[model samples]
Target: MAYRCPTCSPDIMQARETIILVPGLLCDDAVWEHQNAVLSRHYDVIVPQLTRQDSITAMAEYILEVAPERFSIAGHSMGARVALEVWRHAPARVARLALLDTGVHSASADELPKRQALLDISAGKGMTALADVWLPPMVAAGRLKIDIALRERLYAMVERMTPEIHRQQIAALLGRPDARPLLAQISCPVLIGVGSLDQWSPPEQHGVMAADIKHAHYDVFDDSGHMAPMEAPEAVTSALLKWMRDDRGLCK
Candidate 1:
């Protein structure tokens, strides 16, 4: 059986704008796979490869160069950092913004040790073992017991990301900026969400970002963690549909 979002259909794509989706650390299409199918039904969707640069700022510039003159951005985790950079560099180009399971702060010096350790582990033992240690924390702890397919999909995605790509993205995350200062400057409609159990980027952190954006819509998926798009796809997709259809979402 094929799944199509109730409000989304392939016929709706004509003359629509583009929406670029950016994935986080060790994430690729699998991160946006669900949202892409539903949302792309209405908009021209493009999921860019985020591995070409080691800095969020550079990555944003690269995306802007290739993206349509005006487009929305949906970025998760580290990709959210890059989206902020995009809005900072070219505010006029982004029609709407969605930041999922991400934060507005810089990594603490203490976080460096853990980031480096993940890199070292992946380099030494390979991505499968790294996925063994990692894939669990990405979802609500309860998900491991109930969702075998989600767990396997995440592990497979991580295993496909090369060690060098993982290291590049990790380094980019470790040295990323505190985006709080720029949050107030976002003039476009903003959508922010996080899993209630997201330790990597807690809901409270997204609340802070939403506080600064005058028109931000926020949500917390109780059944999810860092990977809300996968753990709670139906909920996330519905929220994204509302965001895309609302008149306020297209306002500058």
Candidate 2:
């Protein structure tokens, strides 16, 4: 379903083009709360729920099935990977692409066991305990201490998800396709962003992706972590605005 998040911005104008925002693992519409509020003013923005699928290919297919004939698409974390899959399947249908705080590599050697550790936590102590252990490291070191609201929102989102949903997403990610080969062949405008202090998917990882994709705009949100859309909303939004703009200056 399309998520038009509640916004203080004036009632949206008639939008001309569609923009799909894909949330990361264990995330919901709240993750794109800020961008949805602002971007909806100009485009037909929708945040697709990735909760049902057990594989990246399935998630991508879901988005493509629901999306417009042609649309600008952006994804955060695992969502970014899904966006890549979408592009991989139907590049001609994507008007523009944006990838934030994500990676293109397949599962690393140590990834499965590390992810299993969190799975074990959720299975045993429950989602709340898993959130306490897993969420902190995902953000910048001091972020949670200072941004109590961000911390709470993220925890609440994770807690709302059941262990089975988490397992399905993990399964999806573990079996994700290696997208590096597709990077050099992308013909559409691309935006790649990451947080300066993003420990999970560091800036260097994105820098390499930028190097691979021709003319991809690479941005780094300083003082932000893995959650760039939430942690650095303004900068991320601005970059997306520019990336989505065409010669006529609209998302289409």
Model 2, poorest ten-residue lDDT window?
1-10
TM-score for each candidate, following the candidate numbering? 0.91, 0.91
Q: Across residues 138-231, which tens digit of lDDT does each residue of candidate 2 receive?
A: 8889889999999999999999998999999999999998999999998688999999999999999899999999888899998999999999
lDDT of each: 0.84, 0.89
- Model 1, residue 169: displacement in angstroms? 0.3
Off by over 4 Å in 1: 1-14, 249-252
Which residue pairs of candidate 2 clash? none
Query: What TM-score does structure 2 among the candidates reach?
Result: 0.91
lDDT winner: 2
Worst 10 residues of 1 by lDDT: 1-10
The digit string of per-residue lDDT tens for model 1 on 1-252 reads: 222223455554324778899988889888889999998887888888887678888889989999988788989988888998999998888878899999888889799988888888899999998888777888888677688888788888898898899888887888798899998887777889898899778888888889999888998987789999888888888888887765453435
